[model samples]
Structures are given as structure tokens and as C-alpha cells.
Target: MRQLLYQLIFFILLGIPDGRCLHMVNFFVPEFANRGDKVILECGFSVNDREEELYTVKWYKFDSRGKMSNFYTWTHSNQQPKKHRIEGVKVVMRESNQNFVTLKQMKIGSSGTYKCEVTSKRRNRNPKYFHPNENPPRFNVIEEEAKLQVVELAREPPEIQGGRGNYFYGDDLNLNCTSKPTYPPTTLTWFINDNRVGNSLIEDDLLYKDDDLYVTISFLRISVQPNLFRAGEIKVRCVAEITEEPIKASMLPDKKEFKLYQVKLPEAMKLSTQTIFDVPLFGDGCTNKLTKFILVIILFLNFMF
Candidate 1:
């Protein structure tokens, strides 16, 4: 219809008839933004008419609930509510909405559907000998939509819930990993000595403390062997990774890194003197008199010195 309208106007302006030639152009690209990131949404259009025209651009927001509201409008200047406040969000346009509108300090609340409608109306003059019914006027309308998702960065590292323990041989170690609630939720994994805990049975649980927060707790139970760690310590760590299922594939996933937890190995039982004593290292078989002999020898040596 736009091409037909252009042809009709051209024929009338030049006082000639040509109905086969027409042209149209359009461009559309969606926008993506992260939480607290500065974003720019673009909406551009073109017209083939040689006559003077007027273009109007309006930007609307569709919230998470699917509710839509008009927020900003531009004809040649700003024409939207001034007193209304959307936290840390603003729209900047130059040359037109052709360049795009900026959203500053974007937040989670800034997410949703952003609709930009560019409508161009041509002011076609009626030829002196033409009738209004000869050509049905056409108007240009282009609507582009972009969905913005504000992803919150993971804040808290995964923490061990219970305190340190005295794990001994044949003991079953139960480690609880809890990560600070995060957007897009998080998966908890247990690691021992910088390796994933693969030999244990793990149970997962989730707790919702806030709308933006989704906490996950994982219980890892593994058999402890006094042989595996004879003396030093056992190092365990928990990693909380933001699942990409909730976010688009195009966006980067967030993750939290936690420091390792060092659990000291239990001390070995002391050997008692009664268990083995009075045993001579050198020439004696039975040492009942060796202690006395050794004591006398040490005393004589000291006196001589």
C-alpha cells in the first residue's frame, strides 16, 4: 500500500501516469542489557516520499506481568511525563529516535518489553484537477520490540553451614553448602582438594527468602578414611553457579567463587611407655638392669666433666 501510495503521488506531481514502480525499506534489531548496565534501544525507519512529512516516535514498556504503559514520546522534542520517576532510567534521543534512546544505570525493574513505534504521515497536496477519492492515502507505520532482562551479578560465595568437626576413621562426613540467593537461581557443587565431590551422594534443597533471591543448599555425604589423609588436613570448597536456564543463551552466566575450607585431621593416639619401655637399642636382650646401668654411667660421666 505504501508503494502504491508513493506511485500515485508521484504520478500526480509530475502530471504523468506510471503504476508499476515502487520501493520500501525497513531495519530492525533487538536490544539486550545486563543489570546495572547502560543500554541503548534502537528504532529506525525510512520513507521514499519526495514530499514533506512528519514522523512520530513513542516508546512503551511491557512489564513482567505483560502490562503495557506508554513512557516516552518524541516528535521533534521530548513529550512524556516529567514528574514520574523510574529509578535510574532515562531516554536520550538525537536527530530522532533514529539514533536510539539510552537507559542509564539499568536495574532489574527495567526489564520487560520495550516497544518503539515510528509512524510517518505524509502531507500530500491535492493536484488542481484531482479528486480526493482518486488516491487512497497511505501512512507509514513500523513497530519494533525488544525484551530486556536485567541480570543481577552473583554476590555471596557458597558457605559451609555447620561448624568444624572431628571426623575420624570410618566416619561419614556430611557437608552442607549454602549459597546466597541469586537471580536465575544457582547450582551448588562440593569439591574436595580442588576436585569435584564425585564419590558422594548429594541431596539438594532450595529456599526462597526474597523475590530476587533463590537460595540452594546441598548436602554431601562421603565416607572418610583415616588412610587417605593420615596427618595434614582435608580441603573442601563449594561453588555456586548461576544456571543459564533462566537467562537467554546470548547472555553470560554468573558464578560465585568460594574459598576452601580446611578440616584438620584428628590426632593419632599417643604410644604409652608401658606399651614398650626399657628396651635397649644396643647390646642387651632384656633391659631390667640396663636402666640402672645407664643411669650410673651418665652420673659418672657428668662427675668426670
Candidate 2:
């Protein structure tokens, strides 16, 4: 009776529930990653007793839609790791092992929750913990999971349309700004003379594309004023960016800005008129009509005299 009580006390002290021997020690997974980047996922575990041996290690993934599937597995008996074919998951064989995996060229579709499962089994019975009359589970499994987010940034700068020409006072300025297709769609903002425009003057549109990407478009409409022009030109800027918490301090947000200059209507009209009238009409086989008429009259007088 005293030996059974001691064994119960020992089990309680060790906090071993349901004869589980494998314990997760550490799990390392990056929360954010850019597209086409390489990432490493690591799992560390320990067994409660020396008689327990590692049986197998498996890695599973749950996509954004909560569909679960196994991607990789390693068994102690085989001493080799095997990879399963899955879309958007490229495992580097030379860099992966039983405890960690290296994934290269990550894609936006790789965003999901990843689980690491470790299983262990007892090869021999421990005299102190195991009794002939008591039955225990042969295998124990422990699992840990982490979420990862993969993003694709815009490749080009923002584009501004419909604001290319000159603007006059009291005329309505209508412009549209568009950003390249990217994951987690970019945000478009409008600025006039360095002043940010409010939502009332802006209209937003989003276009969905293949591979879970989006193209963002924004429209700006406001009445042109003399104060908007500085030094005979108006500065119109459109900025596109992705707003999210940075995973690293050195990682900056993806941003692109495009600016266009619109000349004042009067300045543009003056330039147009100068371009039209600046050429001499009397050059190269052309002469002043008044001078020609005077010369003809003088010749006529000379002939009469």
C-alpha cells in the first residue's frame, strides 16, 4: 500500500497527465514573412524518462481556410526524413532535419498555421514507475502550433491619372491613383501641395486578382484654387503603402509615391501663344508688304522721270 501511494505521489509531482512523456520545450516560428523569402521552423522537445525514445516527428499545415494536411515526416527507425508534395511548399532537403525544417521561396499561399508533433515510446520498462499490475499507454504525442503570414509587396510605384493637364481657379480637379496588384492590398492616399486630402474628397475601389492578390484604386475630386499652386505649378502626389506591425525593426513598410506637376492655366496659355506667334513670317523668301509697295512706287517714279 505504501509503495502504490509513493508512485501516485511521484506521478502527481511530475505532473504527467495520461502517461504522456514527451514535452514541448521550445517552438520557433516567424509570424511574418515576405514572398520568395526563406524561413525556418524549429521544434524542440524532451522526454520525461530515459527509457522513452523518439518515435516520429511530423509537420502539418492548416491553410487560411482551415484545411489541415501533413507536409513532412521523420521516423526514428528509418533515420530519413520524407517530404510530401504540396502547393507553395518547397522544402530544402539538405537543410532540414528531425527537429527543424527550412522552406525556400515562400509564396502568398503559404500563409497558414503550422503544427509540429512529436511522438515517443518506451523501449524498456522502468522498475520504479512501472508496476506489473498497472497498464500504461505505449506511445505519447505532443503538439505545438504557430501562425505565419506571408505577404507580397507591390513591384512598381503608384500611378496617377486624369490630372496631367493645366488647372484653372474654380475648375474641378478629378484624379485617380492606382497601385500594383499585391497581397493584403495597398492603401492609396492623395496629397495636394503637401496637404493630405480627407475621406470626403476621396473614393476607394479594390480589384481582386488571382492568387489572393488585390489592386487598390482611389479617386480624388476637389475644386482647384489659386492657393493650391505655388510658383506657377501645383504639386499633386499619390502615395501607396501597406500598413502593418513590423516583425523586425529593420524591416520597413512597402511604400511607393508618385507626384505630378500641373502648371497654372494662364502660364500654360501664355506658353502656347508664344509657341504659335514667335516665328518670323518675313524670313526666307518673304518680305514686308509695306516695304515692297514703297519700293515699287519709287521705281515707277524713277521710270516716269
Candidate 3:
């Protein structure tokens, strides 16, 4: 019986192949996290079908300066690090699973490279005396390092309702500037001819609206002559601050900057006489009436001549 036991122990200590002993490990979280936001750090092993002996998983963090230090060390025992050692950080490990560790409530300080180390045991001739594996030993496990990134939350852009339309002189032009749903909402200002309009000038203004999230809208109106079109070079712009630039980069199939649309007068207009030609009617009722009126005026003048 003793000989049988000794043979079994010899095989476990020296028989297992060396090359397959320790597997590589790596960690990954979302590429970005806002400050004071929740982030998850996952630590896992590269080896598939690893023996149950691999239980201990250690997770550590490094500072922005690239200095690495221990943050979390977990084992089957219920003991955990003192609250003072790891502030604003929490970890949960599952023994029921293959020893997966999840770190949460991440802060800016939590940003850094994280590593997981696992240790397994090899049975010896003496079961209780079973020694920790030495050849493919405690130090022989895989190491995977993943970098954590922290970012600031982005502010929402203000909303611009309705677009610029043709208006004759002395016509009431009502313009509204509304703020869109934003994280850390902001106030809006209405501008006419590059001048800020006062609250008294606003025809209808409500500084705040009742909604789940914070929002505000301002409305302003002014009467100006059509010739002021030069001044009404209207551009409604909404600006927001974000950690990421909103532009999406796409490569054009061809290298040329093509003009997709060119503004040209209609073919019929080109054929019309130079004397105050009427605009050719296209679609809808209101436009047809205007075109007919202009045509009648042109015909009347030609008849009188």
C-alpha cells in the first residue's frame, strides 16, 4: 500500500509536463470610464481547462506614474484587505466559478495596469503533506497586464429648433433656442446679428422646464428688413465639452474632394427674358400662388410696353 502511494506521488510531482504548467493571464475593462463612475476590471487566465488547484487570484493596480502596487489579494478564506488599504474600491470573487474576480466602483486612482496570479497544488505521497507544486511551481504561472483608462464625462449640446427661412423687412421673426438633455446641463443664450438678446426682448421665454433631467429653453424675436440678409448670415451653433471628439473618420473611396451638389438656376429660368422673370412653379399650393402672381405682374408690364 505504501509503495503504491509513493509511486502515485512521484508521478504527480515529476511526471506532469513542464511546458504546459503555467498559463498566461490578462485583464480587460471598458476602454473608458468617467470620473466617479463605476468600472469593472476582469481578471482571467489564458489556460483552458486548468486544474481545480488553481484558486488564488491576485489583482493589483498601478498609478498614473506607472508604479505598480498591490490592490487586491483574494483566496478561499473570507479574510479581505482592511478598508483603509483600499478606499473607494470593492471586489467580489466567485469560488463556485473558476475563481473569477470582479472589481467595481472604480476611481481615477484605480487607473493602472492590473494582474491576476493563481496558485495550484500538486498531490504528494503524503496527502496532507501534499506539497505545493515546485517544478511547475508557485512562481511559474502566467501574467497578463491590462491598462485602465479614466476619462471625464461629456456635457450635452444645446438644441436649435427650426432653420433659417426667408423673411421680408418689418416681419416678426421668432427664434427659439432650446437646450437638449445633457449631463450637467447648461444655460442657453439667443443671438441676433451676433448680438445677445435681453430677456425683455424675448417674445416668449421660459428659463426652466419640468423634466426628469435638467433643461432650459429661451425664445427671442426681432423685426428686421429683408435687405439685412447680409447681417442675418444665420448660423445656429451648439457647443458641448466632451472627453472624446464627436467626429467620425471615414476614408473616401477616391481622394478627390467632390462637390456633390451645385446650386444652379433652373433650365427654364435661363431661357426667360431678363425683365424681372417669374420663378417657375414646382410643388405645393403656397408656392404655386406666389409664382402665378409674379408671372401676372411680368405679363402686365409687357402688355403696357
Candidate 4:
């Protein structure tokens, strides 16, 4: 009898071939987390047979040697929080369907490998090593692990600055929009008179880190159109935004430069006039024959008188 018990123990401790469980479970974990936010790691399992067999969950962390150190456990509708845990880290079982562990107030040090394990509960009947509610018989075991990343938020908005120049029609227009160093990088979009710039235009964005923050600078380069530039400088606005952030980016003038030109009248388009053949002007040396004849008649009449 003792030899048979020893053989059973050897098979149980040594595990089956490949040491992998037959059941499968999916894990829902974020690739990264924002600082000061809640990070929820979920373990999802679907029982195709609709079996409601009692199950227990345990969450652990793997060391550099790939060894698991248990930090939290769930049994009998209760959970145990992790040891050496950061502030606000706890295990929460919502809907009694799956396992979920929430890490609160995440920081840079919170980055690490985390694992979730689930198993079916069974009664340990042996009297010599009998225990209640601890290390119950486990079957159909499944495990999943992931690496968590944390990032800080950047609160400042981006600044858009336009180059100083007396912009004229057909002149090259240049504008620069610089963003404050921030996490997750900032996005800068160029607009002219509320119209968005297209990808085919001369525009580009550059990013660099300043200390621990990320800064982005977007530049606009395009030849000014005649109708787009007018009496004054064109109003080109630089808008900056972060995709994950809830707040809107700082506003730059949404200005467009329209070109203006003077219109001239052609000679063919002027008013038409009629021609005059005998137009006379005073002090001209032209002979007045009628005036001489009248003067001779007047002298003869005077002599007869």
C-alpha cells in the first residue's frame, strides 16, 4: 500500500508530459499604463460545457529566474492582497466569473512581469495532510503572464511660432510649432484659414526628448499662393494636441495669406469717340477769306456815301 501511494505522489509532483495544462484561458492586460492611474489585469476563461465547478485564482510575479512568487490569492469569494505591494494595489473579483487584479497609483518602478493563474478546486481527502480553504486540490490549471509599462503625463501645451517675414505672393512661407516636452509625444497639425494641410504639402514633424520629457516640433514650408496672401501677413495657425490626452491643444492663429494684385484697363477697352474734320482753335495762322471779302464791301459802301 505504501509503495502504491509513493508512485501516485511521484506522478502528481513530477507533472504530466510537457508540464502544460489542458485547459486554455485568455488574459487581458494593458501594454502600458499611465502614472497615477489604475491598471487592471484580467484573466478570462470560458467553460464550454457550462460547468460551474468551484474555482480559485492566484496572482504572482516572476523573478529573473522565471520562478513565481505568490502575492495574492482568491478563494471562497474572498481575496488576499499582495505582499510588498505599492499603494492601492489589490485584487478584485467582479461578477464572480474571472480573475482581475488592479494596480493603483502606478509608478516607474511598477514595471515588471506579472502572471495570473487559475485552477479548478477539489477536496483533499487524505487525513494526514488535510487542510481547509488552503492549497485545495487543483486541476485544469492555466497561467498567463505579461510585462507592464508605465508613463507620465505631460501637462503643458505646445507652442506654435511663425517665422518673421514680409510674406508676399509666390514667396515661400515658413512656420514652426514647438511642443512642450511631454510623455506619449504631442501631435501638431497645420491649418490655413480653418483648412487642414494635406500630406503632399511641404510640412514635417520632428520629436526629441528633453530630460525625461518628449518634445515635438512641426514645420511648414510652402510657396505662398497669389490669392492666399493679401495686404497683410497671412493668418496660419498651428494646432497641437496629444491623442491620449483629454484636453485640447493650445491654439495658434488660423490665418491664411491671400494674394492681391492691381487691375489695369487696356486701350481697346476704353470709351470710343467720333472724329471732327474742321475743328478751329484761337491764335492759329489760317486764312479767313470770307472775313476779307466782308471788309472790302464795307469800304466801297462807305465811299459811295
Candidate 5:
């Protein structure tokens, strides 16, 4: 009894008649689909009264700007389906009928609200078969609508740039994370030692590609501190995510590590002010051979003296 009451309330909410005449039974539309995929839209109905007969079925689409257009239609008298030419919508006539329509190679522009209208007619009780003055049949129409979103996913995980083999304390670390081209660019996040980093330490950018695709890039910068290291290393991770309706796609985080070493010097002997310089080492060339020769001569002269 409770289920029946719920059904009645649902019908009332949808403004559908509760009688056994002509009514919609079910409607199916995919909530999400990947780009370059084939999609099918279905509409089902039932007619219980013998006097009522199916009249016409039509499909319409609403774009992002809320513009409506009819894409397909089928009439019961002709028993043939008709397709209207529309950008980003390719109808497969061989696979389409009064009940369903097939879209081939759906693209990003295909993301929109789709509506199906079903119409039925009730025959006149006092119908004159050959009289031109008879009144037209009464038509009852029912419609249902749903939204679809088409998305393109990245082909590979995010790549990290500007990483070094090692790091020193009190140094500034700057890195960049980049994601491949995809529709509706991905969001990037940074982590250090399994802890999320604050937004102040990160910067984001997007590069537009052809066909409504984009590349996402994120930059991370932070000062190195002793507490940021664990087991003599610092771990960095970057995750790329795409959020869409009814589904979400994410790739495995890209990870990197930098070795950290402490300066081994006595506190008392360490200078209060020091200037560190990076000196280049000489290779095993003519200069090195000349130095070796001079060293040998000095040793011989010292022995003779």
C-alpha cells in the first residue's frame, strides 16, 4: 500500500495521468559519455485503450545557450523516421526507429539537454468514415528530458619538471606539474610527505588546444626546512583530476624524491659568516699532467736539499 501511494504521488508530481489510457512507461538517456563514442537515446510508452493509437515521436536538443532544436521525428502513418541535419549530431538512420535514436561519434559539443516527445490520438466515438466535416482526433502528448555530458580524458599522467637530485636546507624549491591535452582541463594538486600543501604555495595555468581541449599546468614553490624531510629525503607528489557529472577521472599521482644531507661541522669551529662557492674540478687533461709533473720535481728537490 505504501509503494502504491508513493507511485501515485510520483505520478502526480510529474503531472502524468493515473488512468490506463496512453502514458509514458520509461525513458533512457545516458548521463555521461566519452568523446568519439556512439550514444543511444530511448523512449518507451504503453497504450491500454483500444481507441487510442500512437501518433508521432520527436526528439529535441537544447544547447548550452538554452537554444532548442528538433533533431529527429517519426510519424505512425508513414512508419518512417526523419533526421534533421545538425552540427555535432550524427544520426545513424539504419539503427534508428520510432522508439530510439543512435548518435554516432559524439563530440564535446554534443553535451546538452535532450527531450523526447510522444504523442497519441484518441479516435472520435461518432466518427463518419467518409465525411469531410468530421472533427479531428484528440491528441495527448507526453514528454521526458535528460542531460548528457561528453568528456575527453588525458592520455597520460602528469609530468613534473624542475626537480633536482638533492636539496639543501634553507633553499627554495620550485617545480612545475603539467597534464596532457584533454577536454575541460584537469585540476592539479600538490602534496609533501602525504600532507596537502596550501594554495598560497601553488600557481595554476591553462593552455587551450584545438577542438575544445586544454592543457593544465601547476607551479609549486616552497622554502626547504628541516621538518619537511623524513628519513633523509623529501617526497613530492602531483595529482591530476577531471571532475564531471556522474563520473570522475583521475590518474596516479606523479612522485619524486630529493635526498637531504646535513652539514657535518662542529658548531664551535663553524664560522659565523661564511661565503660558499661552487668550484669546478679540473679534468684529466694537459693541465692535470703539468701539475703532476711539477709536484714530482718539487719532491725530488726537497729530497736533495
Candidate 6:
């Protein structure tokens, strides 16, 4: 229809007739930043005219209440907002590219609708025509609102006590681990050197208290022991898993180390006037003395001395 109108105008202006052509250029400014942020508004030009003409461009901003304001202007002599408020926001022509506008250090008050207005200039005509429709046609520049959020870091586990005792191989070992509660409850797992242990039974009896600030008390009860087990310093470890990583507090052995010892008593006691010399040197029998001969000899030696 615009081409038809231009052809009709050309027929009226001159004696030539041409087919109709309709061209519409739309403005688009998708999103903007908040205060202390940067933004770039784009405005492109499209023309449908037989005569090549020069185009003039300008930018405006509108608010939610439909209040319009001239935030930026682009033409032969560039014009910008005069209010001291927008001084921090520097609008650059984007390296001599008239179609794009770059604003830096944008402020919250600069949030509004922006329109890129372009006016075209014809060589022979005094009246200028804007390539983009100036009426109800403009790009909107809007500043997004900021929001505040609080994030709590993972908490440390509490000190553990009791539950220490002799654990025979294959006997069930139950250990209690506790910690402060965390958002999206922390994942818990038990590991034996890198092997994952299941928690179906332990999770069943997990208790919570203290305004739920206290984390889920995990009771790890291992029903089986590995083949490397012994009464020696077998590292009985309790690892609490929060997140994918493990936070561990091992079960240290008591101060006194355990050792196996054996003691054998003599089958019978030998009684004689003289000392028995057939007893083994390392046997318990060496610790006891024969009575009659030893006592009499000791008395005679004392009298001689």
C-alpha cells in the first residue's frame, strides 16, 4: 500500500506508473538493566522509496504511566538528556554506527520506554519523511527490577560422644552423627574407603529436635565387617556425607591398645629336701621354691657366716 501510494504520488508528480509496494519498519528493544548497570538499545531502518533519501534518528523513553521523556537524540548534532541525574549514563553512537545506541553506567531512574525515531531527508523535497512510522511506532527501553536473596552455607557437624565399645567382627556397629540443619536437607552417606554404604535401616530411626535446626541424626549400623578385621587398631570410621562430598569424624581407638596374651600354670608342684633342678627355665615352676632342703641349707649357711 505504501508502494502504491508512492507510485500514485509519482504518477501525480510525473507521468510514470509503477506497481504498488508496502514496506513497514518496526522498532525493537527487548530488555534493559537496572541502576549501575549497562544497556544497549538497537534501532534499525527500512525504507520503500524509489528516490534515495537521507534518514534522521532520535530516541525517547516512556514510563509505565504513559509519561514520555526524551532520553537520547541522534542526528547531525547529537543531543542528550540535560538533567544532572543522567550524567553518569554516557550514551555513545557505537563507533559512528547511527543504528545502534550504547548507554553505560545506567541508573534505576533511567528505566523507561525508549523509542528510536528516524526522519528521512529527500534531495528535492523541503518536507522530510521518517522511514520508520513515528506515530505509535517506537522501541521500549525498560530497566529490570533488582531482588534480594539470602543464602545459607553448609553447616558443620556437632561433637559426638558415647557409643564406643568393643565390636567383634560381624557384630552390628551403630554410630550417631549429628549436625545443624541446612536448606534442602543435606544428603547423607557412609563410605568405607570409597565404597558406598546403604541407609535404609539407619534413616528409619533418625531423630530431629531443637526447632529442626539440629540436622538429621544418622545412625550407621553396619551389619557386616570386612575380612581385614582384627582386635588390633582397625580404623572404625564414621563418615557423614553432606552434598556429594563426605564430612567425616573417625572413631579413634582407646588409649590402651589391645593385645592377646597367654599364661600356663604348672601341672603339679614338686616337694623335696633338695631343690628340683629339672624344671624348665621359662616355666612358672621356676618362680616357686622347694621347701625342706632349701630352708635347711639356708640355715646352715647363715650359721657358718
Clashing residue pairs in all predictions, respectively, total: 0, 0, 0, 14, 0, 5
Per-residue lDDT over 9-122 for candidate 4, one digit per residue giving the tens place of the 0 to 100 score: 999975433323335566877766766677778887644232233366777766434665676666645543334443224433342234566666665445557887777543
Select the stronger candidate by lDDT from 2 and 6: 2
What order do candidates take by TM-score, descending?
5, 2, 1, 3, 4, 6
C-alpha lDDT of all candidate models, in order: 0.55, 0.71, 0.46, 0.54, 0.73, 0.41
79 Cα displacement, candidate 1 (Å): 6.4
Candidate 5 per-residue lDDT, tens place, 1-305, comes to 99999999988865543334777788999877778999999998887565678899999999877998999999999998999987778999999998889999988788889999988887555565635455665788889999887767765678888866544555568888888776655677788876788999999876655655667788999877768766755678887766332222233223333121121222332222111112123323455578779999999999999
lDDT of 6 by residue, 1-305 (tens): 99999989877866332222212244456442433445666666654364323345556665545665555555534443222124233675443244566776554345445665665443332236534444333222212122111112233533233344444444455655554453212444444433455656455222332221224455666543444234322343344333322223222134333221111112231111111111111112222234445778999999999
Give the lDDT of residue 221 in candidate 1.
79
Cand. 5 Cα-lDDT = 0.73
The candidate that wins on TM-score is 5
TM-scores of the models, in the order given: 0.57, 0.66, 0.42, 0.42, 0.67, 0.30
Superposition error at 249 for model 3 (Å): 28
**Considering TM-score, which of the candidate structures 1 and 2 is the better prediction for this target?**
2
Worst 10 residues of 1 by lDDT: 271-280
Question: Which is the winner by TM-score between candidate 3 and candidate 5?
Answer: 5
lDDT of candidate 1 over 1-305, digit per residue (tens): 99999999988978542231221244343344555666766665555455434366677788756877766676733443221244435654342344366667776567677787776554456656555687655556667776666655455467776533354445566668777755556677766655566644788876544334456778877765533342355666677766544322212224343221121211321111101011112222234357668989999999999
lDDT of 2 by residue, 16-125 (tens): 44365678888988877878899999998988666588999999999756888889999989879999988788889899988889999998788889999999977545
Candidate 4 runs further than 4 Å off = 1-35, 40-57, 60-81, 84-100, 107-115, 119-121, 126-140, 143-157, 163-173, 180-184, 194-205, 208-213, 222-225, 230-233, 241-305
Candidate 3: regions farther than 4 A off: 1-16, 24-27, 46-52, 76-84, 92-98, 125-139, 158-238, 241-305
lDDT of 1: 0.55
Clashing pairs in 6: 3-21, 61-113, 62-113, 114-141, 273-293
**Highest-scoring model, lDDT:** 5
Worst 10 residues of 2 by lDDT: 271-280
Worst 10 residues of 4 by lDDT: 275-284
